[model samples]
Target: MKKPLVLIVDDEPDICELLEITLNRMDIQTYTAENIRTAKALLQQKHFELCLTDMKLPDGNGLDLIDTIQASPNPIPVAVITAHGNMDTAILAMKKGAFDFISKPVDLAVLRQLINSALKLSDPVVTKERRIRHELLGESLSMWEIRSKIDKVARSQAPVLISGESGSGKELVARLIHQQSSRSDHSFVAINCGAIPLELMESEFFGHKRGSFTGAVTEKKGLFQAAEGGTLFLDEVADLPLPLQVKLLRAIQEKKIRPIGEHQEIPVDIRLLSATHRNLAEMVQTGSFRQDLFYRINVIDLHIPPLRDRKADIPALTEHILVKLSAVNKIRPPALSKTALAALQQYHFPGNVRELENILERALALYDGKIIEYDDLNLPISTHNKLNCPEYAPDFGSLEDYLEKIERKAIILALKENKRDKAAAAKQLGLSVRSFSYRLKKLNLDS
Candidate 1:
């Protein structure tokens, strides 16, 4: 068998010699290039399993090399070397498609681990396993961008913080990330940080001994222990109280957790993925959330756009929801009339995907026909008023077009009246959450 080859690109002779020596000891053949110009030439002549380059080079930076490689028909996995403590540059490199990064004055242990991970990409089995397709269920441009980011971020061990409105499926995004990562074989424990009681937060997170408390009849494993060698998703992480924040920070930084009433701390290995709809930066400014903890968890941030923002996906989402609802209920799924769909496309959905499901479930229960009509929808009076308003009239192509214009105006007015709160606007408009969401998309009124 031919030995796996690695390409090393660095301007510094000492660094090149050091990496070559280290890799050679591992029986990995290496080709060295003192600049990007030489590295490009070597890449054209060789088939390397991996490439490691320094961010700063005499001819060009690592980013330039990454771009050149990525533009090629088949690009090799590449890692970059950044200056010590240059987290911003490292993150930029990752976003630009670098496999991973090592800081200058790098530890050989970390370097070896990075190389091994990059080489794993060459294995067809590992590549297939790491590309777990996420069930995000949207074709909007925003969703496509998110999927791309997920694929890239899954390859790294960095902490990721997902931000979006309530019911936007942040947990689903986290699960997809876990599935696509190297930790796919391990457990994925999700915890609702807000649901746990203040007194029991620590115990729930770090577990407890049998005799630790009055109700402790058996030893319990906390989320950290339960999620050992896996991913721990803390949903609504901003809800954690100040005291628990300190403990959480310690565990994250030290990679050790001490259960309640336990003297010894247990070492834990976990990839932390946290999410919240609330503005954490604002919370930090107001002294509600810990800044240090915020910085720690938000190493690579991803924001999911609200359903209202991606109104273009309403039809597809509705179809998916209807299919799932029909399968579970063991009933023939009803087809939505154009008017019914228009009603949904025009209304603003404040509750997002959850509200959409709620509206559909309610409609399914009330209507007993193969086709769901506009009247059968039982939409709010606000939507009707939009069509019947005696205000200034515009030149209409048809009655349907006029009603649509009216609905657009009414939804926009309701959104403004309610300070853009989808739930409140939906309630005030007398439309179901799903109807409001659908209408928002139908009329292009969602912001």
Candidate 2:
């Protein structure tokens, strides 16, 4: 793997040398410049994962670099170095698109942490790509159903609400919707409602004009405006505060936004998609979520199924992840033994698809290019024990009753795992078309 590069811009030679030495020890390559012009030239010549610049420069202010970086084709995260009393300027730097700012006489440990975090944020596309490459590996009925739903929902502009346990591919669904929409030609902007700090929430969603607040030194476009003519994906929408929820509702309803410290509303032509792992209806009932907003955003809903419910898809999913991971790691693919596959199928994945991917990754790390045996798969003992337990099992008076109970449980689990794929469930259980129909009807589990 290539080492991440850092660009340090400061007039002080000693500081530059110190940072270069410190970062090089951590295996990070460093580039140093004394002024804004040299820094910009270097930035243009080569891409740096991150940039740290002093607020005071000989030719120009470091805040000016923020605008330049944002305008660049490949924007490098920039952090402002400010004096103790220059906190106001540092805050201004952040508002102007600086990833973060540090006070002068920087603590090496704190600076290192900030640099590492910023590098990760600077290249989210890579992480997103890695995630997608890991998904879509299942061949079960539930997997096919999810694929079908993605296809169906992608064809519409209706607002979609995706609900699932964490790691169940809610964001992946959102991305698929954006990719298939009429606005696919435009940007697909995603924001985590719960992750934004309460104080910065407004600025993040509605943006701010220059001089809007203590740190607002320049006009900035929020995610909504940034996603104009495209799709705006609001992840964890249920986490949005009640007050901000009203503002978001107005934006969705009116198709306009008024930036902070600005009088006029900017008209936005965009498709809105929101996802939440939380139960919005429950939150609404508890008076935590606004009923009006929920109704507005949930014009269409998509629920992702957990992995355990779609056990039939386990074989395909395992093979898919293994192939993808092999390609990425540039290694020969390992085979999954039948016993190993059975082990995976029997396990209850509380984290859903995400958990399965993680387990597979661990298996790959230990496989040594050999077939993954049951012993090679280090699954929890509890999972295997549950599969063998008979004492607490169901007792049916007749074969019909036993089959009925099994069918009901399978259907319910399928719906939950495949995010509710009727056809997939029927296929997985090896039932005839009419037989599955009758079972669903008898059980009153048909949706």
Candidate 3:
């Protein structure tokens, strides 16, 4: 088998010698260049699997070399070595199409990991795309564009901030990116940032050594350690506390973490992916979120459009949901009546794809024979009372179950009307604040 070829571009002879020695020890071939002019010549002359260039070059900068490589017909993966403590340059290089970036006074371990990941993109077997379209579940132009964007961004090490409404499959999108990336073989660790206790946030993220604190009877690895050489997805990242956000920004910027009770900082090799339904820009303006942290995580924003905008895909989405529900219920997949399909498309989906699934699953249970009608959907009524039709009454489901559905829809409607203000929504519904909060938890709408 032919060894992988790497192009090492740097003006310093000592740095070039070090990189050449490192690659040679790893059973890889290396071609050296002193500056951008020499690197471009080498790039045109040889087919290299990966290229590593210092940020500073006597003739030109690394960004120039990156641009030249990307403009070529067949662009191999490129990485930039930035000066220590200069995260802005690293981020800029990554945005300019560098596959990854490593800090100067380089850590050889991290460099090895970065090179391996870049090389994986050149390996046909490891680089094959993971078919994840079925999980996305829409055929609109927006969905198509999202799929294309995912393909492009999966090749980079930049932090991707997935923006979408609740239940719009933000985590699913993150998982897809991880699965299709060079880090696919490693773990894809996901955690809801809002779900963790405030006191334990630091320990949960950076881990703690034995006897680190009251609960530190045993040493535990944090999400970063667990997701080493893979991806760590922080869902609902906007909910993080201000203090934790500062620590998080440092970890991401430095690519190193100091677990609680540990004296030395440890180098961590992992990709960061975050998501939120909230408007982070607004949060930043209000001083609720750290601006530096926001910039670090939101290198690239991928927005998944809500279902209402893609109503044309409703019929197909409903069919897909019904099939899954049928399999779980041990029943044949039911067909939706034409009227039912139209009713779904006409209604606005505040909870996005998640609500659609819930409505369909509930309808499938009470629906008789194989066809689900409009009434079975139990869609929330509008201010004008659209369900006033005499035929809208269906008596198949029990009173208890029917009432629960009514309660869920009524609460959803109230929340939507009041802009999700629990206090105002409770007053509008003639319920106490505590009761409203309870109802939200009971209806599984608190998230």
Candidate 4:
């Protein structure tokens, strides 16, 4: 059996030797490259399980090499080595497709952990299967960028705060992080903080002894206990009462929880991932949420782009949702006509992905045929069309006619204000350039 090979690119001979020794101790083979050119040559010559490169290479920087490697047919997962205080550079590298990063004067334990996670992606079958299982199902630029961020965030034990509108798949993102992390085999316990009553919040989060309270008929574990060695995802976490927030902060900070009515605190090992549609920072300012707790859980932030922002992904999302609906209903998946898909793409999705799912489910139930048509969607067109309607219109007409007049007048006014700078006008109107251009064509304002 061939050993897993690692390519280490560093101009420093001592650091290269040290890394080779460390990796060899783990039964991994290493190839050394003193510069970007050597690293590129080595990469072309053979397959490597992972690559570790210093940020400043003698020939070129790591970011340049990363970009080059990504364009190649077979891209290897690469981790960067940055100066101890150079976290900004490390984050930039992560955004540019670096698997992970380690600070200089490196801790061997941290290096080993990074290596292990990178190795997981080296296996083709495991990587492919995992990507499919935890798929975000979008091809838009925003979706691609978010997936990259998720991959980087998954390898660490840091608390992640995901913010997005309701029904935007925040929980799915949390589940993906858990699935991709080392805790994949362990339980993924998710709870809606808003749904739990204030009275039961403590008992639900921390286990209680039998007869601890009136409802405590038997000894039961709480979410923390159930999520031991795994992940605890607090969905709608902003809604957690301020009083309970203090206890939650203590538990997260100490990694120990005292059950309700229990005298001792038990240790827990779990990663915390939290999500909320509300503005937590604003909540903190209003004294509705604890600032200390917010800082603790928001170590890293992941914002999911709402569906309307990534309209290009509508077709793929529609198809994926239809397939799921088909499997659950034990029927053949229905195809959407071009007109129906166009309608979906044109409308704003205020409810995000969840709304799309609901729309498809409704279409599947109501439409008896194998193909879903434009009318089958039963989408509310008037709402989106009238989104920017003026407060007063001189001429009363049908909603469609009124929307047309309002849209044309708004476009003309915006164009005149921005001196016909379509991009600037689009920005002022809070519309994407594509959407603005499409509207101009639809309303005969292109002239």
Candidate 5:
């Protein structure tokens, strides 16, 4: 069998000689180049499985080489050799489509690992068929751009910061990236950083030794250890307290972690992906968040557009949600009338997709007819007022009876919208908790 070939590009002769000897020892063939001009000449001559280039070359920087390689019809996997502690340049190279990066005075173990990963990318077995495609489910221009970026970033090991409002599916974007990456076969551990208690955050993130502290009855694996050789998605990462941020930065940069009560540090291989609805830049300016950690994690940003921006996709999203709701309830999925969909599209969804799903679930359960009309949807009165009928429609019978019916309908709508939480519904309707409870009983809606 022919040996796998690699191109080593660097201005220093010592670095080139070192890399050539290492590759030869690993049964790989190497073609060496001293400058960008020679590297381009060698690249033009024949195919190579991988290209390792230094960031500061005599002719040009590593970014220029990355662009040249990425623009080719069949781009080979490339890694950058950056000077130690210069993560900004490393991040720029990764953004420009470098497969991965290593720092100067490279450890042989790390170099071998990087080379092995790049070789896997060049393998024919790791083809498009192997990629697991998850549905993002939208056809808007912004959605198209998001999908394109996801595909591009999935091929790299760069840390991605997903920014969007709550319920906009930032974690879903992270999952899609992991599923489509070379790390798909491993665990994708996701944790909401804010959800963990402040007292136990360290143990939760870095694991704990048995009997290390109170309530430590058994040894526990932290999220980092659990996601070994895979992805760790820190949802709501902005909520991480300042103290833990420093430790997290070290673990990420060094690729090592020391669990609570442990004397030795364990090397962990994890692809870090994080998300936040809060503004990190603002938080950094205010000293509430670590600026260094912010820069480290925000190497690339993926923005998820709010649901209101993609109103054109509401019909399809509504249909998909209805189908799932119907399957769970064992009923035929109801279709949305044009007016009802228009109401949904017009109402600014403060809660984004999550709010849309809740609205559909409530409608699916409560509406009796197969076609959901405008009146059937329990949207805010502002939307319902456009084509409202219950108010203006005349009643020939007792006036008191009509008024009672209207009040009953309004109260019932509030309860459903608030998920049967009487207190919240009362607040929405400008009533005290006691008054709301009395009204629910009076209308016989408490049943």
Candidate 6:
């Protein structure tokens, strides 16, 4: 809803006025500065979507401004205006963080195009900040680890495989990766492998020529092609069919794709990042997933632990989610009663972080600005007793008795839920399979 602001900096008043008029005609708000000092002052005081400055300023070189801008918290996309035959300076400008360089006799059309592109780059950062303010609001160790991984991974072009339970913030992680990557200047394409029908998978991945299929009334670019220099996040990647997996493997290996009905393979420079809730190793063992393809994508594995494993982060996560929901709904954030907080801390989030967000959102809507009490949480009452397990609660009985009861309950629940699959239950319980067998032996439940 806000028009982009463009700052035009030139030593010559006429040049600044001309560009201001042009930008104003395009419905972009303009700010004019006649020197580097004034430009820097304006930049510090206000946020401009894009900046156009002369390569040579009265007090300092435009290159100096580029360095200063790049060091700022939110740097504006900069374009250097240089004299004709100053190609060397132009190159240097770009190297110093200038988005583009324009010649002295500026062609208004070219200048407009460059400004337009620079403004477009600002959109992603703006959109990302808003989304973070809305969706991401936690500082838990698990959340912090994820943020740290995103920051580190964004600097490289490696293929990342994010494995987490459903509703565990996979998409948010993908977005952060894209936002922090070198290819942040390009588009980020995301697709859910499980949501697309098998018959349309090829068309969706490689796009299609007009008239190639029944619904192909026009030529379309596939997700891979659209994300050419950026990232392609394949959500629910385990759902990709076996046949498509082969094609995808080849594409990743060769760095190209052959669109449906096309002869020549189009070269693509995509950074692939895939996520799935399913156990990939188990899938591979069962022949449901390609082992080679798994190796290709699992170059850098980032496992987002389930929320239950990171219960220490619940308070921060709860507050963050509540604030975000309030901002989105245009209402004041509701208060969480101590009883409600205690109840939430006790529950094992089977759905993980996503379930926690949903629960908070539901509570906000249900309570409608009122204080959220324990009853308002609507979690299983049994969860409260589970929280009172001796690990967190003060011991009232012999240590041996507490340990036996906790172990018995955990084993029974794991066995029942895993349908007596001891190995699988062991993994869920974070125990070695052999140790689980010994536990069954000790409990006399081996039969």
- For lDDT, the strongest prediction is 3
Q: TM-score for all predictions?
A: 0.70, 0.56, 0.84, 0.61, 0.82, 0.57
Q: Name the lDDT value of residue 160 in candidate 1.
A: 90
**How far is 49's C-alpha from truth in model 2 (Å)?**
46
lDDT of 6: 0.78
Model 3 residue runs over 4 Å out of place are 129-134, 382-447
Predicted candidate 3 versus true structure: per-residue lDDT over 94-172, tens digit per residue: 8888898888898898889888889888898886555444466677888888888888788889999999999888998
Which candidate ranks first by TM-score, i.e. highest?
3
* Per-residue accuracy of model 2 over 16-134 as CA lDDT, tens digit each: 88888988988899999999999999998877988899988999998888789978876667888888645457546655666666666776765765565566544556335323332
| Winner on lDDT (2 vs 3) | 3
What ranges in model 4 sit over 4 Å off?
A: 1-134, 368-370, 387-447
Q: Clashing residue pairs, candidate 3?
A: none
What is candidate 6's TM-score against the reference? 0.57
Q: What local lDDT does model 5 show for residue 298?
A: 90
Task: Judging by lDDT, tell me the better candidate of 2 and 5.
Answer: 5
Which is superior by TM-score, 4 or 5? Answer: 5
Query: How well is each residue in 115-225 modelled by candidate 1, as lDDT tens digits?
Result: 776676677787787765567788899998999988877766678999999888899899998888766778999999999999989889999998899988889899998
Please give the CA lDDT of all the candidate structures: 0.83, 0.75, 0.87, 0.83, 0.84, 0.78
Clashes of each: 17, 1, 0, 0, 0, 0
CA lDDT of 338 in candidate 5? 66
Which residue pairs does candidate 4 place in steric collision? none
lDDT of 5 by residue, 2-96 (tens): 88999999999999999999989989999999888898889999899999999898988878888999999988888999898888888888878
